[model samples]
Structures are given as structure tokens and as C-alpha cells.
Target: MATFIIEGGHQLKGSIQPQGAKNEALQILCAVLLTPETVTIHNIPDIIDVNKLISLLEKLGVKIHKIGSGSYTFKADEVNMKYLESPEFKEDGKGLRGSIMIVGPLLARFGKGYIPKPGGDKIGRRRLDTHFEGFINLGAKFRYNREDHFYGVEADRLKGAYMLLDEASVTGTANIVMAAVLAEGTTTIYNAACEPYLQQLCKMLNRMGAKISGVGSNMLRIEGVDSLGGTDHKMLPDMIEIGSWIGLAAMTKSELTIKNVSWDDLGQIPDVFRKLGITIERKGEDIYIPAHKEGYEIQSYIDGSILTVADAPWPGFTPDLLSIVLVIATQARGAVLVHQKMFESRLFFVDKLIDMGAKIILCDPHRATVIGHDFKSSLKATTMTSPDIRAGVSLLIAALSAKGSSTIHNIEQIDRGYERIDERLRAIGAKITRVN
Candidate 1:
């Protein structure tokens, strides 16, 4: 097992850049299956989840070549879409949630696809019925194998129709969108999960000649085409990483500038943090963070009531960053309710911060209020293991700014999203070491 030994209390002093978005990368990789030409994707993060997905693609005869750092050229010509039936495929698919994306391209290319129950952070009930149902609406047949805990679906050719998802599930929406892009006739996805990740996928599909409108809205209209050709694309910068770095710099009392951020994509984030008294200055494509901005105060409402930070779908605060926002709020002045409606288990990480001498109220599984900017004297270092990706990175930030030395195990979870986090953090004066 690997663990990160971090000695806290030193303010980070340098700049760091995060890799591309993992969520977008997963979908983009699978979108390659829609074409038989060489598709090049730039700024691909070398994370485990991506590697697993790439491995699956390779097993199915998708020839992938490393063009340069954080870039790949994928050729899906002569790809065997039948690898979905292999035992190894089922095992790999069950271990990662992104594997569900295969259903879309497979159903489009081979008229059938099989996937086991997808696995990811055990945060709450994530249903794939919406995905299968969307396919069924497009005239696909689905069968469940309870013995193997898998799903088998096939169709002569998917004919697109209207699809209203049960919820705005991220991966589910992406899967259905991919299927509809090449299906016959026009498709409309209402109440879709149009996060930046999904928007990137939409833009990429459009670039590949799939007609999709409503890039950042709830309703997406896709004109299904006969076939999609290859395209060169660079993923937008990671918004979650940018937000995390903002939180980390504020918590550790550092001055840093995050460059290459897509300012247009980060709607409501600056204003959201301004409510918490965090000052952010934007210069062109870069955002500058104030050094030692520890007096982050929670602004009251127009009626002078305490502010509340909650997560909703896109154009609202993202559920993925709720944990980091909660962690940062622990060091901000005043109090705010951090409501995470998407996942029940996301709030469970409060125990680690509570152990760090921070004042936190665990209201329940979905809500918590953080009273901040008041450190309870000394915070003795302790050992903790990461549970999930976002919570894991938030804990790492907390450990880096806390007093004394702390050990964080299960760093694999953190690596699943963030690329070369230790090196990036170290470049910014964070004292972290990986030990076997």
C-alpha cells in the first residue's frame, strides 16, 4: 500500500497546473468507437480510470497510440465490438462507472452491447435503468442476467426518438447522447446532465459532424447522422481542479495564479466564493489568488441571514466539488450549510475534518454546516485513508495546511482524478512524500 506523509503548516508558494478533465476524457475516449478513423485527443490525463478504459478499448481492437504527453490517437477500424462478452471485460466494466459509456457506441456500431453493473464511489443509488430505458425508447431490446449481474442489449438499428431521463445522471446522459448521435432520425434529450463534462462531449460530437444544439442547457437536440468522421479536439481545462486549487491556496495561505482556465465555463463559481469572502481576481485567461487570504467571511443574505451553499445540476454548484467547498468553508469565517443532495455518502468525510479540530455539524447524510475561520488551537496530526476522489483531495489539502505531520493512505483514490498531484503540490511548497 502507498501512503502520503505530509507535514503541514507551511504556506504553498509556487504555481501548479492540473491536467485535463477525467470525466470528459472517459467519454471522449469512448466516442472514438463511433468512428473507424484515427481520432486524436489532446491533454488526456494519465489516470488509472482512463488507463482502464483504454485497456478495454485496446482489448476490443481499438488501436491507440501515444502521440505525445497527454495526447492519444485512437483508430477503431476493424474493432471487435464483441469483446463486451468476455469475462475480463465484465470484471473491468463492473469496477468502473465510465465503462457504461460503451453501451452507446456499441449499440450504434454492432447493434448490441453488454455491460455489468457499473462500479464507482458507493455514494448512493446510481441506476442504469435510465440508460437502458433510453436505448429501449430508441427501439433496443434489453435483458438482465441476474446470475452474472450483467445487462445484454441489442437492436437492429437504433431509431432515435424523444428521451426524458429519470434524473440528470451524468454518465447516463452521456451514454444516451452518444447512442442518439448516430441513430436514425432526430433525438431530443430534456433535463439532461449538461455539465461542462457533457458539454465537451457534445461539442466533440458536433465537430465530428453530429448536429447537436443546446450545448450548455437542459434540452439538447441531436440530428442523428449516418456516420461520424474523425476530428482533432483538445479538452477544456478541469474546472474542479481549478476550484480545488482556489480552495487549497486560500486554506494554505498562499498566492497562486491558475492559468489556462476557461473563464466562460466557470459560471457562478467566483460569485459563489465571493459570498464566502474569498477575493478572486481575473486577468485574461488566468485567475490570481491572494496570499494569506484567511479572513474569508461568509456573507449574509439580502435579508441579513446566513448564506447557504448547495449543489444542483449545471449552472449551479457542482456536487463533485461540494466536499472541497465544505472543507474550505471550515476555514472561512461565519457559517454556511453545505448541502449535498446528489449523494448520501459525500458528507461522511466530515469525520476527518472534525478530527482536525475544525467545527463542523453533521446534520445528516446529505447536509452539514461548517462554522469556520476559528481554529481550535493546536491540531495534532493523525492518520487517514481516502474514501473517494473528491473527498480524498479535500483531505489532502486539509492535511497539507494542518499543523504537525499527517499520514494519508489509499492515495489511489486521489490519483483517479488529479494528475501527478504530489509533484504539483510539492512545486507549490507543499510538503508531501509518497512512501511504500
Candidate 2:
């Protein structure tokens, strides 16, 4: 495994651009299978999970071409349908959680789709019931192989119907929308996830001849079309990465400019950090975070109660950035409560921060109360291992602000999300190195 050796207490400068959204790339890449025409996609981030999904599509007979640094063209003119049932496919499909999305387009156009039990971060239990249940509601037959732990859906032709989702899952909503776009009649989905990722998918499908309305709302209506065509699409900047950079600047006491952040879509992220007493300035589309040398103070509610930061659906604070928020709070001027409602195991990483002399109380699997050191005490560096992507980046930020050098093992988890992170940090005056 590769590791990162970081020398702490160094301030970073220069501007960094966020990569294309990883979540959106997964959904957009799967949508390419809906048409035989060339679908050109720009701003594709070069990361592990996204690349794995592209390779999986290539093996299934989708013709892929590199157009530029972060651009690609894909055509699904001659997909290998039989490959879905092959042993090689089972092994490949199980490697990425995003691979489950391909089933939607395949079942829509070809009438059959199969996938192995998908694998991803071990933060918590992520059920596939929403995806399968949505397909069943659209007149598809669902079956599971308990011995092999595989899922399959098939139908001669799907007929549209109304569905009220038990939860507003982003991926689940995206999968169902893709299938319903080619069904026999109109489909209405209430309680849908309206995140920017899903909005981009719906807009792209409309350009491809699918009829969809309610682009940025919880209720989505789709009028099925006979077939979809191809179109060009550009993904939005990753908001999660932008939030990480903001937290990094505050923790390390640096002046960092995050370029081309698409501010209008960053709902609630800036205000949440500002509530932590960090200064965030808007310069056109970029976000400028000034050095917090005196340290930041947490804000209390109007009633003078302690502040609580929690995650909810879109237009709410994202759960993915809670780790970053938690890490930065260790050095703030006051206390704050961080509630990670989406995943149970995400807060388990706090023990590592506690080892570095930060004051934190693990309330439960879903909550933690952090008492800020207020920069009067610097964290002492130590050796650690990365458990997941968000947690890995959070640990890296902690090491960067510590007093001495720190070593982090299993950095591959970080690479799965961020593109060339160490190299990017080095450009911004950060003393970080990689070891094989």
C-alpha cells in the first residue's frame, strides 16, 4: 500500500480548482448507454472509482475515446448483452457501487439487466431495495440469487406508474428516472432527490429526447419517449471537494482561493462554514478563505444554545463534508455538535484525532461534541491508517495542521475521490510526499 508523509505547521497559498463531480460522473456515464449515438462528456475527473466504471463500460462493448485532458466520447452502438451474465462481469461489477446504475439504462433499452452485490465504502449499510423496488413498480420482474448474492431485472416492456419513495436517495432516484424515460407512458416520482447531480442527469436526458420536468424539485414527471439520442454534457465542480478546501484553509491558517466553484449550486455550504466563524469571500465564481491565524469561534443559536451542524437531503448541508467540519472544529474557538445522520461508522475516525490531543466526545455512532483547542494547543503528529475516503482526507487535514510529521497508510482510499491530491497540495506550498 502507498502512504503519505506530511510535515505539519506549513501554510498553503495559490489557487486550486475543484475537479468534476464524482457523483455526477457516475450517473452521466451510465446514461451514455441509453443511446447508440456519440455522447461527449467534458470535465470527467481522473479518479479511481469513476475510471473503474468507465473501464467496466468499455468491457461491455461501449466504444470509448479520449477527446482531451478531461473529456471523453462514448457510443453504445453494439453493447455486449451476454457479457452482463459472464463470470468476468460479476467480478468487475462488484468492485464499484456506481456500477449498479448501468442496470437502469440496460433494462430500459434491452429489457434485461443483472448486477452482482456492489461494493463501496464500509461507512454503513447501503441497501439496494430502493433501486430494485422502483424497477418493480415500473412493471419489471425482480429476482435475486441468494447463493451468488446477485440481482436481476427483466421485462418485455415497462409501463410507467406513480411512486412515492420511502427515502429521497440520490442514486436510487437517478436510476429510476433513467428507466422511466423509456417506459410506455408517463411516470411520476415524488420524494425524489433534487441534488445538482440528479438535476444534471435530467437535463442531459432532455437534450437526448427524454421528456422530464421538475428539474430542481422533489417531484419529477417523465413522459416516456420511444428512443433517446446523444448529446454533449459538462459536469459541475465537486461541491464536496470545495468544502474540503475551505476547511483545509481554516485549519492550516492559510489564504486559499478555490476557483470556479459554481457558487449558486453550493447551497448552505458557505453559510455552514461561516457559522463556524470562518471568513468566506466571494470573488466572481471563486471562493476566497482568508487565514484564520487568531482562530475561529463557533456561533450559538438565538436562544444561546450550542450550535449543531447536521446533514439532510439536497439544499441542506451534505454529510460527506461532516468529517472535514469535525476536523476543523478541533482548532476553533468554541464548541459545536456534529450530527452525521446518514452513516453510522463515519464518526468512528474521531479516536484518531483524540490520539493527537484534540478534545472530542463521541456521543454515539451518529453524533460527536467537539471542544475546540482554539489553537492554544497544537496537535502532535502520529501514525495512522485511513479507513475510508472522507475520513482519510479529514486525517490528512489534521496531519497538515499538527506540530510534527505524520504518516498515513492506505492512502488509496483518498485517491479514489481526489485527483492527484499530494501533487496538488505540493503546488500550494504544502510539505507532502508519497511513498510506495
lDDT of each: 0.86, 0.96
> How far off is residue 169 in model 2, in Å?
0.3
- Per-residue lDDT tens digits for candidate 1, residues 216-314, read 898999898999999998988888898899888877878898987888988778788778777899989888888854357788899987788889887
lDDT of 2 by residue, 129-173 (tens): 999999999999999999999999999998999999999999999
lDDT of model number 2: 0.96
Worst 10 residues of 2 by lDDT: 288-297
Top-lDDT candidate index: 2
The C-alpha TM-scores of every prediction are: 0.97, 0.99
